[model samples]
Target chain A: MLRSGPSVILFLAWRGLRQYGLSSIVAAFSIALAGGLFLSTWKIKTETEKAFRVYDGGFDAVLGVRGSKVDLVLNSIFHVSNGPDKPLTQEQYENLKNNRAVKEAIPLSGGDNYKGFRMVGTIRKLFEDHEWRPGRKYELAAGELFADDRQEAVFGAFVARKLKIRVGDVIQPYHGLDFTGEDSVHPNDFVVTGVLEPTGTPADHVVWIPIEGALNMPGHAEGLGFAPSSVLIKFQPKAKREYLQLLYYYRNHPELMMPDILMTIAPLFEKFKAFEFALTAIAALVALTAAGVILATLRSAMNEKRREIAILRSLGARRATVTASILAHAGLITLLGIIGAFAIFAGIGSFAADYIREEVGVIIELFEYDPIFLQVSAGMLAIGLLSGLLPAIQAYRSDVAQNLTPTS
Target chain B: MAFLEIANLRKSFPSPEGGELPVVEVKEFTMQAGDQLALRGTSGSGKTTFLHLIAGILKPDAGAIHIDGECISEFHEARRDLMRANSIGYVFQSFNLLQGYTCLENLLLPMAFAGEANQERAEELLEQVGLDHRMGHYPRQLSIGQQQRVAVARALVNEPKLVLADEPTGNLDPSSAAQALELLRKLCVDTKAALLLVSHDQALVDSFDQNLDWRDLNAAFEQATGTS
Candidate 1:
């Protein structure tokens, strides 16, 4: 019982849409596909940048052997690669730990893996002092952490769940980053002492063992000597001058390299700029094609419904009423497309977030409200209305008498 | 004053060759309230064009068309459209019901345009036209006679002062045509609305109390054909 006004126009438009069911569905689906891809690509790019840029792993800088600063940070901080080419000796680690400007220094060593999960050896001070974020220290989910002198290990949450290891379970380290040969397995068995709670960082995929366990292993004492892979350092809160001095000092040092962690990670995204741009271009092209589909479908519908429109006019519908009805039809299709787009975006965003967390160890906020969603929706709505314009004009100019006449 | 009046009403379309081709030119015509008048004419003789002018579907190039003392010809196209929606109902020869809408919805459509859509009134009219059982059926689902009945119900849904029916039964068989005409005229009387019917069937026109041939009524047709 809609009165003659916008509501009536909307009612008639909805009826017209339902009358052209398959074409309407195809148009809406195309729009949804475009919108979903646009949103997913944008979200992945922005969220990945945010995650990497704001990464805080409880230390200000990484000091390693003279090598690629990116490789040093990626290996030492993110635990995603083989360790740096050369290791800093225990004497250098002790020197940095005892420096007047250094508040704390944690040594990290990695050479072996268990079931494809990298095992890192670090000091007890790391567990006791480091806060991954301000006021958020890691807590053990099961038993006690490994002692600095013992041949024991702690498992990260993801590794523990994946390998199904428990406290007191014994694991043997493999000689390489991946499972290579039966003879590559170390003879010593490290008892699982604890499992750390989920930290949503690279640490979630690591196995933590004491530095003594890594240094004293069978073949390691003869070939590697007493050297740690890298030393992660934090300067005193009021020692900004000394921190910059040390960074400058390491720039030309013959055997050492120190880099600001944030500076080192920011450039990684630069490598992805071309890939991101390609995805964005493809999304935009699909969106434009979707707009064309809407235009073609609506125009075809108007052609098929010309006689019906004339009959409506003969029943006293004003030209504006019929025209508005066509616009309303387009609006409804766009609305459906936007809703479907959100569903598709959610599905894809969740998958991307999970993949990044598992493979790259970065947590992406998938459902945060980004203005791009609103902006894209508005743009699509405007395009939809524009697509309906020609058909609306055709309806406005329809000849009531001629179209309403009997064909016979 | 007459319920419907037209004075020197003229309308023309652009001719394919050149110049304007006069379609309808009625010197004067009037119908009183509650009256039934039939207009008879041959094919392409300006009968439908004259009806279109009266219904305000087409603007008169020069003249005045007044319905119930209001001059619609002088009004703008939008205002004329509003006047038509609120004061006049139309039925076409082919039972031009919206194929998407049910019989009941078709009856309610005119009322919606009139800004006074009443579901109860639409149902009552459908019942009156013997379409109560077919109210939920779409036009394509209904028979020819049923569709015509739905058209008749729609015409009176707004209780307009004038109902213009253009060959409302032309597509029906002889028996269905006579029945449709009787039902339409009966409903017009029941609603107290004036009826102006245009048809080529002389037998149908003979049933009306008053009837006029289009050749005599439209001076433009007589001039164009060079006929009396």
Candidate 2:
């Protein structure tokens, strides 16, 4: 018995596709276009969001040196591009840590990039703060984390993915601020201890070493004196008002160069939320338009297959059977197209990480495809299926008898 | 009771200008199992319409058709579909063979749709039509007679109790027409299914067991058997 098993149905659906080979290819292309755009934007957005959200690793506030809040915000939070413009000495960090309003403070030292990425020199408290997502904890694929403190280093996922460095691999570091001189590009060789699992964020593209490691380096990076970019301060939720007053008052202290400079713009989170809103809105509009194109293409294809459907009906195919066949065909085409598009993007993700960072400021790791890829792909598929529903229903509802009668 | 029976069958359509237009007004008709019957008519004579009505493809404005003791005309659209799948097969005049399918694919179509892939039965039926060697070829590659032979093979794939064909060989050459008729004759006996062929070809009509004219079929409802 030639029963239509899943494989048989797959074969039949595949065979049915050959009748309108060109149309089927077009359908796939449309689906790929829709799925690809959604995925590329979705992946980049998700990873970038994940990167920015990394700021929430528990430090609600940062009590920097007497001045240069922006520099403090840049370096201590993002671990890059923030100059230690003001030497926020160790006493201030200690003072904030011991304050009634302060919960915890993690210090960061951003020195140099072995390549285009920053080398974050921080403590274990970094991972402890955020309550890292699954598998975010460091695992030793070969050697241990930077236990020795002075020169030992830890690697991020991208170190291996991009630089092809392995545990025990020694790479030269460069001076952070004085990036001009050739000497700045190659500071000293440090052995790669452990490789961090991909966070799908900026961290994935960075290397980690003890703050002392950068502090011991040459002129700019290894701070000659007190090289604190900023002091991260976490305040208890209820401590905001009084602490804000204290922060304002402290800023006014003559020691802070200009203590009167207490600026209140928007909450960092508000800025992020608004940015999120705008990016997602653009993505949604583009996705909707892609969906419309999909609908038009599918509806037109169904019209072309009307006669074939009629023939199937006259051959005793039930309406549901006919409908299923059409749906299956549409779905298969959309699926193939989506996969192709995804493959293209996956290629981009792997091969163009540095280029993307250079071009768009998206510091995503090329090691792992973002996990959100599946969610985005599923959404694309749903959109495609919904797009096809109108034609499928039309094919379903039409009278079999009328369609079966061949017109002269 | 006849193997198939229709009573008080009336079909009407809304005229393009507005009111109702009466199409076919047959009050009664009956055929025994295994009967080869021809429904003859001119263009728009309602021969195809009557065939569709009996095959459960169309609902009469008012009437009933019983096939193998099942009153199909009264069945809902869904049941009619099931009835068509399980008990009836149609051989469209245009050879309505799916162009997407090969010759064997066409022959196997009914069995495939009927959810019974019975390869042995399909092969035997194909042999019955004497075209077993042409299974792999698509319908387009086959001659008109060969394609018609395939249509007949499909009609018997499910061993249906009733086979409805519209102009079964209208496009075929004389030889193909005679051959298709011969296949249809053997199909009725082998499957125990009554065959209803609708066509304008009088020669094909004379070849069947019973012949009925479209104008004569609408005689007084009570005069059906008498006219027969």
Candidate 3:
């Protein structure tokens, strides 16, 4: 027995939940699963969007051969795969470097791998001039940068840690993106010159060599004359007019394609909108079904406890008291389920953040506060209380005299 | 004025055949403070219905049930519930102790509804009923006689001015029934509470200071039996 009205209601509600323990647990678990799925999906969608929006890998655009802008950005900016097959000629590279609109242009050539890690060919200016983020220059953890016209390589942090390579060790480059067999290994053995510190960017997964070494490698097209895969360009600040003019100039050029990094990645998220909607719809359906289960379970428990409820009324409990007790029961279950949902979300969100960082090279902050957490919890709690309304009404309207009839 | 009073009390339930089946219709009844009365009636004789009416568990179609000058029948349902909780104690025949609560919790429940739940008073009542040792036991864990004792303790926990017992010993053996009746009568005398007991057992009714038969008390019962 309790003293206050609310305490009595809460006590009775807690006892009622304990009375039907298994059904209560099953209902709460269903709510947890639905909530976890919704939270995970929503977090992934929002965080992925944020990651792409803020991703500026030192350069503003990629000038490459006429083809898919998305592929060019993926290969040149994110190091996702081997560079494009059609390479930009030395004349095109020199023209872009000498353009007044372009502040700097670094050439990138990639068609080979050292044990599945992409090996990119670029000049020393890449390490000397580029800052991945504002005021954040790449620094070496060991040794020094590779010199031009040498069969030497500088490994990214991830590549060095993964392959266990040191400054003095040498590696044989494989001719293609994937390592098929020993026969695919090139005769060119590049010594490890340095290992870059972790940058938390896609560059952390690359191995860099000189442009001359990549262009002059054996079995390469020698007479085509210094054709790198693509040129990464940085535009001067406040050069929006010149940038748009260059974009328009390249739009009509049959042999060239210039893609702003942000513009190329923004449309990809638009394509994902449909998939996100489908996932949200499935989560909403599951939530509705969970609410239904709460209703059914409580209604059945109410029916079983009719006699007990009548006994309460006989002992001077008001109709409002009994009704509130039922609603409180629903509230308890919903609160427990919401707590469990948070735990489940943490597990799933952490796993997803790790997967995305490792596979896509985009960092997602797992613990960032979002308003969806509050909205989903409050919404589910309201639905749970609403689900208990019918049974509460039934309890309120029960016939005390009839139910309390002497069974003896 | 009497501690308990009833006049022109009428109650009816919907019959299976679509009309009204009269249950209780008493023209007049009265009891003094602390007076003990036994009401005897066979099955379906409106005995339990009369008890329900006085306890305010069921509303009468027409009546003035003045318990300690409150005229509870004229009050709203919520007020009647409060009136019952504060002034009238009820002991059911089957010992309707809540299965989920312990013996002490059962006693404390009524006091809680009355808004003055006192743990000490509940524990003292359990001691008076000789159930002090069983205070922590649920109804299922107690014997029938012990369960009845707990019910008696629960009814008196609020120290109401009146008690309504509907065959309180109906489930007990003869020896246990005698002992339970003795304890109930002694407790009522000690608390200065009027007792209105409804039972069909003549041997049980014979010991009361005053007794009334349902046919003599309830005009509706007599009319239903064609003996009015």
Clashing pairs in 2: A173-A187, A251-A259
For every model in order, the fraction of real contacts preserved is 0.59, 0.46, 0.43
> How should the candidates be ordered by DockQ, best one leading?
1, 3, 2
| lDDT (Cα, 0-100) at A391 in candidate 1 | 91
Q: Is the docking of candidate 1 incorrect, acceptable, medium or high quality?
A: medium
Cα error, residue B157 of model 3, in Å, equals: 2.2
lDDT tens string, model 1, B1-228? Answer: 888888999988788789988878889999999999998887777887787888888888999998899898888888878888888888888888999998988877778888858999999999998988988999999889889989988988999889999899999999998899999999999999999998889989888979998778888886455466
Which is the winner by DockQ between candidate 1 and candidate 2? 1
lDDT, model 3, position A354:
81
Better of 1 and 3 by DockQ: 1
Query: lDDT tens string, model 1, A352-382?
Result: 9999998878899978888998998998888
State the lDDT of candidate 2 residue by residue for B1-228, as single tens digits: 999988888876666778866666887899888888887766566677777788777788898888878888889876787678678888878878877777777766567666657777777777778778877878888888888888888877887888888888888888878878887877678778888877777777877668977667854222222222
Model 3 residue B17 CA deviation (Å) reads 2.7
Per residue, candidate 3 scores C-alpha lDDT tens digits across A237-308 of 777787778878999999899988998988889989899899889888988988998899999998888989
TM-score of each: 0.97, 0.73, 0.92
Runs of candidate 2 with Cα error greater than 4 angstroms are A1-68, A88-178, A181-249, A257-279, A323-382, A406-408, B218-228
